[model samples]
Target: MESPTEKRPARRKDAEENRARIVAAARAVYASAGFDAPFDAIARHAGVGRATLYRNFPDRYALGAAIVEDDLCELEALAHEHGDRPDAFMKLLSAIVERHTETHALVPALLRGPGEHALQALVPRVTRLLTVPLQRARAAGLVRDDLTLADVIDVLAMLSAVLADDGSGRARDRRMARALELLIHGLVPRAPVGSPIGPNSPRM
Candidate 1:
């Protein structure tokens, strides 16, 4: 007979696997059909029963938050990986813009008026993920001395709005690229290295 201990490990493994499948299916369904996509579709996509989907994610908002959390965690890892580079902040920002547009359509579904509080709940975690590379860039004198993390966050919010725009495909992509370039450029220091107005200067 199978011992209880052996049976418990198998059950735990199945539960974890089901949870991962549910999250992955949610990402695909949410990306293609918006957050209002039917949970039944997600369950079918994951090859799981409706019970498993609900077991993993009790509500649509919960599933949406899980997707955002995964994206944020990926962004945080990228920030940490590139944090020591002189252009770390811009690099991080560029990567974020790319990822943001890929999932832009779902933003309204996850963060619109009725769901605003869910977005509010995520702010601190997102901010913490962003601040590290930004501070590193500041310390390296790669950004203007006056730049703050709040400024970075505000710029990102504007970028997300741009991503959510419904213009023609090529035009929208071009505008997003242009907007990101301008944002990065605005953060660059005006003074050349070793100049009187450089980061070391009191006036900086």
Candidate 2:
């Protein structure tokens, strides 16, 4: 037999482990079946009893929140890793596209109806992570000066919408690349078109 304090610590550790297991199982199930995954199925997969699952996450919303938090952490990591690259705009754009594609269900859920304040709050961190490279691209005349951080957010949202419409990941990626290329070219200042010059040398 253990002392009371020792027993409490051990019980707490076990509860923590159980909670982590449940969260992991929920993540796998949710990724495969989206938010439609059954709680019983998650409990079964986690190898925990339904009571244990509920003890860890009382409802589907709690599970969804945990998954969203995990996804955001991953995004933050990616942002920090590639936020300073020479082609940071492209990197950030690609990251955003991949994230939106991977978390298709979650994105739509967060965007639907009200209670998007949490998601909205994350935009500034995203903007700061992206704006640095975007500004650099603008300074190099590689991107449009008229574009704002909000434009980047709009483009990301559009990309998510496109992915939702066309579930073909490969096709969507190719289209996104082409679209970025066009945007980049359009940003270049155009030279005035002089009078059409014929193949012949300048007429005397």
TM-score per candidate, chains pooled: 0.80, 0.66
Local lDDT at 109 for model 1: 78
Residue pairs in clash, model 2: none
Each candidate: what lDDT? 0.78, 0.69
Per-residue alpha-carbon lDDT of model 2 for 1-204, expressed as tens digits? 788987998899999888878878877787677776889999998899999989888777667666666666776787678656656676667666665566666757655634266567666766666778878777765566676778777766665665566644577667766765655444443434874556662321
Off by over 4 Å in 2: 1-24, 113-115, 167-204
Worst 10 residues of 1 by lDDT: 195-204
Question: Model 1, residue 76: what's the lDDT?
Answer: 80
Task: Score residue 148 of candidate 1 by CA lDDT.
Answer: 89
Q: Which stretches of candidate 1 lie over 4 Å from their true place?
A: 113-115, 167-174, 191-204
